[model samples]
Target chain A: MRFRVFVSLKPTVLDPQGQTICRALNGMGHNSITDVRQGKYFDISLAEGVAREQAMREIEQIAQDVLANPVIEEYQVELLEE
Target chain B: MRFRVFVSLKPTVLDPQGQTICRALNGMGHNSITDVRQGKYFDISLAEGVAREQAMREIEQIAQDVLANPVIEEYQVELLEE
Candidate 1:
């Protein structure tokens, strides 16, 4: 199975990096780029036969405990077809 | 249409962040975590009726001109069905 994990700052969090990018974009005349949000991506190719449910459960745990700070971050998990 | 762009360091590049994570993972006993890589993700929602090819070409330009350091980074683009 393949999984793609996106971990991003919550909307309420102050994103200095994103702000910088937004300012740069506006300066570059891409005024339509109203907002910029920065995030991390993890692409994992797991061993075959790993059940989807088990993978989800483990990934959820990783997201909550290791990949993100629950107070300021949110995560999305996608199970991709192999 | 929606698009997801992934910008990652080339395998030949020295990834200090990934090295640190690898060491940390090893310390945490995830010995199977032989390698670690870090990357950035951009999720973009475009205006309706945009042609996929146009969007892809624009994104490729952005990836090459703005989001990625062609010398050390590589990118992948995926058009997500809305």
Candidate 2:
């Protein structure tokens, strides 16, 4: 089984990196470009035979405990094909 | 209009950061986990009235020239409903 976990900063948090990108885009004459926000994702692979339900449980735990910093970041998980 | 751009390292490149995460997962007893690859994504907004094809063209150029390190990274763009 495989899963994808996306981690992003809380909306209330300041994202200087994203701001930098926006400014750069504007500087490049992409005047129509209005905003940019950046985030990270992880593609995780699990051994075969891991049941979907159990994999969801474990992957959720992994996303929470290992992939995200709850105080500033949030995460979402999606199951992928076998 | 809004779009999402996902940027990831080429499979051939070594991802030490991903390796560190794998080690941490294994240490945490997630023995079923086989691998993890990390990547980034950007949420970008463009002013309304920009045609889809034109937006795609400009976004592609922005992605190639500003967002991605084409030599080591690749990018995919997804248009989102306004």
Candidate 3:
């Protein structure tokens, strides 16, 4: 099975990279772009035979403990159908 | 209007960050995780009054020219419904 994880800076956290991208876009004349926030996306392929529920639990734990910085980031996980 | 852009390393490109994360996860006992690929996600909010088609075209251009390095990365853009 495959899983997708999205890890992003918390709304309250300042994202300098995102700001830089926004500025670059504006400089390129893409003025209609008002805001740009950047984050991380992970595509994980799990080995076969793991139960769905267990896999989900493990993924959630991984997202919280390894994939995201709890102090400044947030994460979401979703199972993808092959 | 809002757009979501996903930028990922090309399959042929090596991703050290992702590899490090995978190793870390395995060391942490998530052995079921077979493969991990990392990418970037952008949540962009565009100013109002822009036609959807125009916004999409602008976004595609931005994704290709600014959001991603075409030499090593590929990007996908999608409109988000609020």
Task: State which candidate has the highest TM-score.
Answer: 2
Scanning candidate 2 chain A in windows of ten residues, the lowest lDDT window is A73-82
Model 3: per-residue Cα lDDT at residue B64: 89
List ranges where model 3 is wrong by over 4 Å: none
Per-residue lDDT of B1-82 in model 2, one digit per residue for the tens? 9999999999998888998999899998999999999999999999989999999999899889888999999999998766
- Better model by DockQ, 2 or 3? 2
Q: Flag the better candidate by lDDT, 2 or 3.
A: 2
Estimated TM-score for each candidate: 0.74, 0.96, 0.95
> Which has the greatest lDDT?
2
Error of 2 at B19 (Å): 1.1
Residues B4-63 of candidate 1: C-alpha lDDT, one tens digit per residue: 778999989998886786577568654434455678977655556667787677667766
**Candidate 1 backbone collisions, by pair:** none
- Kindly report, for each predicted structure in the order presented, the TM-score of its chain A compared with the true chain A: 0.88, 0.96, 0.95
Return the candidate ranking by DockQ, descending.
2, 3, 1
Per residue, candidate 3 scores C-alpha lDDT tens digits across B1-82 of 9999999999999988888888888888889988899998999999999999999999999898887999999999988863
Over A6-79, each residue of candidate 3 has an lDDT whose tens digit, in order, gives 99999999999999989988998999989999999899889999999999999999998888999999999988
Off by over 4 Å in 2: none
Per-residue lDDT over A26-70 for candidate 1, one digit per residue giving the tens place of the 0 to 100 score: 687554444556789765445566667876776566567776788
Error of 1 at B18 (Å): 1.7
